[model samples]
Target: MRQPLFVTALAATAIALAAAANLPEPSADIKAAVAASTRTPANLARDQYRHPAETLSFFGVKPTDTVVEIWPGGGWYTEILAPLTKGKGTYYAASPWPDGNKGVQNKQTADAATYGHVKFAAFPWAEGQPKVPDGTADVVLTFRNVHNWRMGYQRGGTDYSGEAFAQMFAMLKPGGTLGIVDHRLPESASDDREKSSGYIKVSTIRRLAEAAGFEFVGASEINANAKDTADWPKGVWTLPPSLSQKDVDREKYVAIGESDRMTLRFRKPR
Candidate 1:
């Protein structure tokens, strides 16, 4: 039987994006980690779109380097990362506060075997000191978080996004990699959308990273979702995972899967 048009289209998008990203093939350990049983089944199901193994490989994450993940909302990637870096390296989940994310905290206690060694702490906010020691981290990763940083500043008085980049820079070793993945807004979209919509422009992120003294490393489309146009009743959340619109056009948005994302890599000067 012939394949459906939508399926063919999505496959084409993945192919083109992968080519554009120049993503490295996943290392054996990285692939095994992503496939590890420690990861949540729900999170694993999303791997079709997230491509965790390839994405991390693209960022050059290793087993022997200290890694700090900023704002690991509910420990999606944390499930894979914490165990991957165990013993050989360190994994830190830096958020606003540990109490703020009790879900991960409880998981740490309940599943000590996987999360016991993971360090959970506060992110350096509003000129605060970085919880991750300065000049020590080899890789700092943030997934789908840049938009929330914009929201923080737009709603509050602080420039959280700007501060986040600077703080990340402070914690990284020279030649350290800063890997960021977030929903992508079209460059043609009005600037105001960035504050409300969950999507951010690639230029905006590049500007912030460059301002923080990071050298642009490269980009990967390992998480791109072309069906999403970034114009939703509830922004990027209108897609799967959140589906903020509820049953209204549910199938339509579900067909779109996740939001289109820009996977960016930057480096601190050696």
Candidate 2:
């Protein structure tokens, strides 16, 4: 049955609103953070592909929010997030290896003046007491770490990825957001590829998040790359940055740049 014109118009408007830009432009603080001089030139160069400003804006980060970054390998986002939250907010580099993970630790230590306010929290979470505390964080961001969590578990004493999602869910305030960016595997790809290659299916990610009590808020293509094929002899590492296949097809992989990625956001229901 056809609805009345007013009802139909309202329905269309709702759909359009849902499809529009989920959040506003990054605040001046975030833009300044991206342009901060503390960041190394090499890390700055990757800005074209990473689009740190746009991604964080889409995640709805604010200077006053308490943010946690999961498994911040090499502290790539730390250069921006740490100082962005400094003085006005709290930023925690949540890692499984608090003391052992040198990448973020060294980055924090080396730039104490800038990252001085940054805190470290054990992720995969400790048993005694939760590090960040349940229902406390305003935002939790994980960049390209989902596949590693899936791979870390052997045959299945426990599911690391599932646990990670549950922990993240617990640590978020009701209505808080979780932003994720990871290599995307096409829905057409075989399931086994997710276990071997660094790429993961969007469905798998949604299932994990939803099961952990998060509602799918929206997705963005801000970090999408048309050049990547998501197939390599040595997996996604065969691409630049890692370039695991060094010199074999260095030119080819360099041209491809980074893997195609999915940017997703979920909300802990209020």
Candidate 3:
């Protein structure tokens, strides 16, 4: 009877340990950062659709990792990232400098007040200069900037996607991560449409990264939106926020909300 009881106790302990190993930990700090008052209500409202917490988790972001955000347009993610990485980690806004872009200037100013120490790295898009140093970043992230790079490629014949991706790869340490979130176009969409439409195929992006010497880690549906048909009148701009149509089926576009996006992760080989 005593031996049987001992065996049962051991089995229970083993099961408990297994469960604890698999249980998801609370991202309490990240949640608190997102809820911080520094973030505007309009940016906060998009949390339901953006799923920032889950998306960051999928990208394997750590509090102490050195992160570089490529073209942080309007600093939507910057608000969350700046606070989260305030103490230990470094946050670099790798964007165009000396271009007199209001959005970039506004973001840098807001970031200083919000984080106290946000580093700005200049990316000369036209000159194709490498903004970030080699083997420094733990993660390099870009959101909705690929189409713009493609345009630069078309206009300058510099293979902007290839050059930019190689620079990103060079900026990371071995085994470091590259996280990308961009508007997704259907697989059936023509490659040429990427210039006009604010969308790119997943396969095309994967190839770009692979060519730059990064391995495909995985992809997440955290940013996917079923409502997006990818064939809007003014492209992705037809969605909310932009609403380029302006009062033409305004309510209908509002119902559809933001464009569907692809969340992808890649890794530098160790």
Candidate 4:
């Protein structure tokens, strides 16, 4: 009986120590900033787009690094990133056109006002190619936007997907991370399917990153939705949020929620 009691006490002590190790040091200022910014309905909805804690954690963001969020649409992550790095880190939003034509500029402007330190840089697709300085960014992130480049919208006769990956690879310092999240296509699908379905095979993304000089670290299923059949008639846009087939089967699509996304982490070789 005494042996069992001793073992139990030891286990409890170990558990307590582990919990203490994992707890982040609370910052009252960060909490206050997040509270102030998320008061609006728009900000609230944007935060709901993904699991904030999980997404930010996956990026390995701390309060003392220079992080760049590529194509930060409506500044969804911007809302979280600004406060997470409020006092110490720098957050830069890179995009094309400062004219606010594609909603990029507007989001950047709004984030700048709220975050104060959030900066913006022009990375126009029409400029032929992106050129980010080497060993500059500590963390480069792009969420659910790779499919747009795959579709060749404004890629300017270049494989924008490949070019974007290369640019990210170049921008990161040795040992820096590149976090990507995108709607996943069925593994059996081909590259051609991306044009129609707005999804790309996970393997294809891995290969692209590897080709662009990144080491594929691993992937997460944190945002995986097993219910998605990957057979929507209108592609991923047929699902919730975008709901391209609004009048046809709005309820069915709404029930489906968002597409299953592949969460990937890649590292620039040190």
**Tens digit of lDDT per residue, candidate 3, span 1-270?**
123343334334433433453422326556555556677767876765676766676677887889998888677888888887888798888876655234546765655666566777765344554366789999998888887787674347444788789889988999999999999999998888787788889998999999999999888776788999999999999998899999999999999988899989999999
Write down the TM-score for model 4: 0.79
> Which scores better on TM-score, 2 or 4?
2
Candidate topping TM-score: 1
Candidate 1, 55-149: lDDT as tens digits = 88889999888999988878898888987898789998888753545667777988998888888767754445338878999999999988888
**In candidate 2, which residue ranges exceed 4 Å CA deviation?**
1-23, 153-158
- Candidate 3 lDDT score at position 253: 91
Off by over 4 Å in 3: 1-26, 100-113, 124-130, 153-159
The sequence of per-residue lDDT tens digits that candidate 4 reaches over residues 144-176 is: 878877877565534578887877787799999
**Superior candidate under lDDT, 2 versus 4:** 2
lDDT of each: 0.83, 0.82, 0.77, 0.70
Task: Score candidate 2 by lDDT.
Answer: 0.82
RMSD of each: 5.3, 10.2, 10.3, 9.2
Alpha-carbon deviation at 261 in model 4, angstroms: 0.2
Clashes of 3: 0
